[model samples]
Target chain A: MLHLVLFLVFGAICVAGAINLLVQSHPISSALSLVVVMASLAVEYLLLGAEFVAAVQVIVYAGAVMVLFVFVIMLLNAGVEERTKGSRVALILGIPGVLAGGLLVAWVLIERTGTATVGLGALPGFPKTIGNLLFHDFLLPFEVTSVLVLIAIMGAVVLASRPEPKNPEKES
Target chain B: MLSLPIFLVASVVKIVLVIFILLTAVAYTVWLERKVVGHMQNRWGPSRVGPFGLLQPLADGVKFLLKEDLTPPHVYRPLFIAAPMIAVICALTSISVIPFGTAIPVAGHIIPLQITDLNIGLLVILGVTSIGVYGVALAGWSSNSKYSLLGGLRASAQMVSYEICLGLSLVGVLIVSGSFSLQQIVESQRGYFWGFIPKWNIFYGCQFVAFFIYLMAAYAETNRIPFDLPEAETELVAGYHTEYSAMKFAMFFMAEYANMITVACLATILFLGGGNGPLFGPPLLRLILPTFYFVAKVFVFLFTYIWVRGTLPRFRYDQLMAFGWKFLFPLAIANLVVTALVVAYRS
Candidate 1:
């Protein structure tokens, strides 16, 4: 009963934070709301007994990545007044988006209920299990992910370094 | 019905006890710092509050409480208010995993000194401590002041760099111990090393190097002098807390001291035989002695912190980054390799 209450509370917070991120006028407020969403997800992960993953979520998403986002926002001087106004067209289209998301969640719940089983055995040492899965089963995907990250880093550097174009005559 | 209510009350009492101890320790740490720095600088400090200025922290607490809380005109009010609370929460939460003493029997119930003993206790500590950087960074950014923002940036960079080394240094200890559980690690250090020295991390050859790196990295990670460029009063003018006032400012101060104690305690547990000493008496006495020994070791580290603060000058910003990246990073890698080889050969 307590777990159910806590889960619902956390899930509500996560949804509320996500909605706030989308609706908020300020980019900084959106970033702060995103942090709340990330932290709620981390708590959910913790409740699921994936402590290491939860820790990584908090450390990486909340600590490193959010700080980087805030850093860029501050550096770019992206103030609340500069935020792009929300379009009515997007709000109109969001009805379908929400419907699709709700249907997907419902399907997942139904599938989980249909496949429910009891008496699952304990897995191996958690770190070892995760390590083995990463190295053995998903080795190619893991390496590919690294390559993707490297590409993203290089792209960021290139974008950050590109010089502003001078006049047309100077270009010629 | 009775059992549920009893459980709730018991847990509440436990939480209260833990908070009380943590707050008291943080308060006394300030007193310890003043006394230690005073003696180091050959000057009397805080001699007016109580006997030997023992109540100085209480006085400071009252002053902070009574001071007018100020919010800068251009500051982000919500984030500014949230930052210090986040800092204090993260600072105090890490203590949940720390085993302060052996379980004591109270009215036929064995109550552990720690609040919660998770299996992955060390990781929890690391996770919580890493999150603490956000508070400092957020405080600086939300203040809308150049100095505060710079301090926050410096703190974030310093924390991120040192955290890598700090985590890497602990990899050696974790490798040998074969567990992330703090209680298990302490229990594993029960035996002797070559018949004399305790089987602590510091006693091991390469582990000693790792311990030293961990110590240095932890000091930097916690933003202590001489690595405290973020909070350097000479330059940054109180750094991230520059725009904060009253109880909010006090929260940051408390968080810093609390984090210092947490790091000191972790060092004592990891490198110093963690609540383990030579058996010189009966079972009860033996158990009690180790806790005392652990506290004494923590005091030593805390004193070293103050001594270093009084003696060493702050590092230049560039020098700090260079030292962390160029020196400590490579040194930690070398220590890990050496430890792995030693462990392999021993096996």
Candidate 2:
């Protein structure tokens, strides 16, 4: 009973934060709202008993990623976003498309799960369990994914580097 | 097993006690730092308030409360107010999971010294520490000052970079202990080698390299001397808290000391075999001695902090970043890999 109530409260907060992220005009405010969204999502993961996932969600996403987002926003000293007239193509297609996608997902979830309630902390909540699952059950896929991430990071570094000077000695 | 009502009440009581003790410790740490740093520089610090400045924190608290609270006209109001609260809150929150001593039996219930023992306690501390970056970042950005902005930017970057080293360093300990719970990690460190030296992670687990890495990374995380570029007085003019005045400023000060204490406590728990010491007296003393040992270890850690502050000059911004990323990061990773290999072999 307590878990359900807490879940609903945090779910409401998560959705509210997501909406606030979109609605806030100031870039910093929007970024902070996004952080709130990330934090609440971690709480939701905790409710589902993926404790390690929940902690990692907070540590990696809300903590590191959102911090970088806030850092960039601060460095750039971004101001309140100016409202612009709606782009015709986006206005025409985007809203309906998003609504349809959301409805489809909700319909599928409700149809498949049939409103069945899961007990609080029902899934494997221990780090050892998760570690075993990752290492023993899904080692190949995990390694591949990590390698993929490494490649992406290398690509980013390459892209972000400045090109060599045409005449380095002359410039010096 | 404790009844739910008893557990709740005990939790509340523990929470209150811990917060009070933590705040008192934070206050005295400030006095200790001043006294230590001043004596190192051949000066008497804060002696006017009380005997050897014992009541100095009380005076400072009252002064902060009585002083004019100023909010700069040009600042962003909401975040300017919220930043210090966030900073202090995150600083205080990590202490909840730290087990200070053995369980004490009272009124037919045995209560652990810790407030709550989440299995992922170490990760929770890391998570809280990560989130704490925002308090500094937002404070600087909202201050509408160039110094504050630069300070915030440096803080966020430095903290983010060092956090990897910090997390990786602790991974060595986590591997050695095979658990994330702080209490479990300490429990694993019990017993002695050769019936003399405690089998702490630093000695028996061969985690000295990791401890060194953790120490450096922790210094950076808490923004202490040699890594305190964020609030460098010479360049940033009090850095992120320049616009804050009175109690708001005090909050940031409190937050810094609190973080220092938290880092010290964590070091004791992870590397030093927390509260594991000899006991030879009555049952009451046995129960109390562990906590005394824990506090003594933490005090030594805190004294080391002040000692280092008195000794080392601040690191250059580039040097700090380069050291964290180039030096500590790889060292921590190497330590983790080596520790994992050894643990696997032993098992």
The candidate maximizing lDDT is: 2
What DockQ was computed for model 2? Answer: 0.92
**Model 2, C-alpha of B233: deviation from truth (Å):** 0.7
**Residue B302, model 1: Cα distance from true site in angstroms:** 0.6
- Cα error, candidate 2, residue A166 (Å): 1.0
Which lDDT values do the candidates have, in the order given? Answer: 0.85, 0.93
Per-residue lDDT over B152-173 for candidate 1, one digit per residue giving the tens place of the 0 to 100 score: 9899888988998998899898
- Estimate, for each residue in B1-347, the C-alpha lDDT of model 2 and write its tens digit: 78999999999999999999999999999999999999999999889988999999999999999999989999999999999999999999999999999999988799999999999999999999899999999999999999999999999999999999999999988888989999999999999999999989999555999999999999999999989999999999988988899999999999999999999999999999999988878999999999999999999999999999999999999999889888988888888888989999999
Candidate 1 lDDT score at position B330: 98
Give the distance in Å from residue A64's predicted Cα in candidate 1 to where it truly belongs.
1.6
lDDT of 1: 0.85
State what share of the real interface contacts each candidate retains. Answer: 0.51, 0.92
Q: What's model 2's lDDT at B207?
A: 94
Runs in model 2 with CA error above 4 Å? Answer: A110-118, A168-172
DockQ of each: 0.53, 0.92
